[model samples]
Target: MQGEWTGELVGPDVWVSCRELIPAGSVFAFLAEHRAALSPAETFADMYPSRNGRPSMPPQVMAAAVIL
Candidate 1:
């Protein structure tokens, strides 16, 4: 599988870029901020899958991000 990616700050000058395989230490903020860069299906499945995969975010956290 192939996809687009963009890097963002995890700390001062430290960056994390999500791609076909996300780096293990990437934070939720990085994933959510760059959500649009990935395929819709991949984003949904990875970020909010119906069953086992990566853990889904709480509704409150998702809502907070959407509001920003």
Candidate 2:
């Protein structure tokens, strides 16, 4: 069943952030900077179910995965 996006952890807190690894001028960095501004998650929020048995992947995460 479709569910709300809750998000998942890929690694520990000590792990280096993606922003640190990606160069500032790179496309990834640009996307990262504009990710929230663009509000992909909020834009697509209504596409997913709000209530269900299990939480779904975050809309922003899914959008990033598709873009990357």
Candidate 3:
């Protein structure tokens, strides 16, 4: 994958894609799993754009933000 790729850890050798987790609805379960791994203020920071007027959110967050 050259661009943004979403996947879940099913096993040491398996990275189940988000589509595999929930084949129907647009549920962002993967973010929920890694939210805790993110540092303090990271969640809010992820929600909002950059203060310097630069593009807000990381590439991954930007992609997911569209769903929200």
Model-by-model lDDT, in order?
0.42, 0.61, 0.42
Could you tell me the lDDT of residue 27 within candidate 1?
69
Write the residue-wise lDDT of candidate 3 on 3-62 in tens digits.
Answer: 222444335522233446554433455544443354333445545553554443344544
User: Candidate 1 on 1-68: residue-level lDDT in tens?
Assistant: 22222333335532234343545556655655554553243444454435545544444334434643
Model 2 Cα displacement at 52 (Å)? 2.6
Q: Which pairs of residues collide in model 2? A: none
- TM-score of every model? 0.22, 0.55, 0.20
lDDT, model 2: 0.61
Off by over 4 Å in 3: 1-27, 41-68
Q: Give the TM-score of candidate 2.
A: 0.55
Expressed as tens digits, the lDDT of each residue in 1-68 for candidate 2 is 24344445666422235557777788877776776566556677577645655667666766766776
RMSD for each model, in Å, please? 13.5, 3.7, 11.3
Ranking by TM-score: 2, 1, 3
* Model 2 CA lDDT for position 57: 64
| Leading candidate by lDDT | 2
